[model samples]
Target: MAAAKIKKGDSVVVRSGKDKGRTGTVLQVMPKEGKVVVSGVNIAARHRKPTQVNPQGGIDRREAPLAISKIGLAVDGKPSRVRFETKDGKKVRVAVKSGETIDG
Candidate 1:
């Protein structure tokens, strides 16, 4: 797998989907699946029919995984591509648009 441009805790913006253009922090990264879970985005609601596990199961709402391609690293409130560059003898992520270095 290539290097991860967007990691957990990264601020990202949805490129397309029902939540297009929405911004949120990345809650999880599933590189193996090529998906990511962002906070307050792509929420899926499940209605439970009351089971032994949960007697009064009304609804379960939570963030769902979105394709990594649907998201971009947020830079200055906008979506931007990320690139890696060697800085100070270490690798770091940089915003392609504004040329700002993200935390290493």
Candidate 2:
């Protein structure tokens, strides 16, 4: 997979869709699909059958994967675009809005 602009654990904001303006932490990144699963965003209900873990399986709510283009990285407590830059011999993500280094 190509290098990911956003990584797991990074805070992000939804730009569009039903969850627009909502913010959440990155839970998983699917580079191949260009999608991400953020906490508390794009939630969906899934019906489950009885299993060893839960005999009374019913409906379960969980976050669903969203297109990466629909979200932006949160920097300085706000949503902003990100760019890659070389800093001290290492590559890092930088926030365009605040000109701040995203990954420390």
Candidate 3:
């Protein structure tokens, strides 16, 4: 497993891919796979097989996992690199671009 800078609820912007430049919230993180699923990004359709949730079993559209390297964390409304820093004796994530604390 690897450490992931992006976590659920964090805002991010796609750096490269079909979704490039699009900003969305991080819905899930897969550090083991180096992938992260962003809401409203990398959408794909899956054909259902008539499950209880939907008897009709129509196609379902959902966000797909994107390579962790393909996205950048959004801080201060801009995409930026993330770094850890100690503030008031507590470690937190900091945005390299804006020098702002992202998480406490």
Candidate 4:
């Protein structure tokens, strides 16, 4: 699997697609599939079958995964590039703008 720069809870901005320019937190990451689910982004409706527990069948709103390449990390509310760096013998990722390493 390829290494992923963004992780869960990281803030990101949609670089392209219908949600372009929208910013949201990263809810999940799928490195193998090169997809990431951002909170409040790529929402889709799902039809549910009524079960004994629910009696009423309804549509539910859910988040859908989008290609990782379509999103960009947001640093200090600004879209910036990211790079991996080594500090004190440990590899860490940092935002290019502030040069602050993002803790894992």
Candidate with top lDDT is 1
Evaluate all candidate structures by whole-model CA lDDT and list the values in order: 0.94, 0.92, 0.89, 0.89
lDDT of 3 by residue, 8-78 (tens): 99999999989899999998899988999999999999988997878888888999999999999986666
Tens digits of per-residue lDDT for model 1 on 1-104? Answer: 67778999999999999999999999999998899999999999999898898989798999999999999999989999999899999998999999999986
Candidate topping TM-score: 1
Runs off by more than 4 Å, candidate 1 = none
Write the candidate numbers in order of decreasing TM-score: 1, 2, 4, 3
Off by over 4 Å in 4: none
Residue pairs in collision within model 3: none
Model 2: how large is the Cα RMSD against the reference? 1.8
Colliding pairs, model 1: none
Evaluation by TM-score, superior candidate among 1 and 4? 1
Minimal lDDT window, size 10, model 2: 74-83
Q: After superposition, how far is residue 82 of candidate 2 from its true place, in Å?
A: 0.5
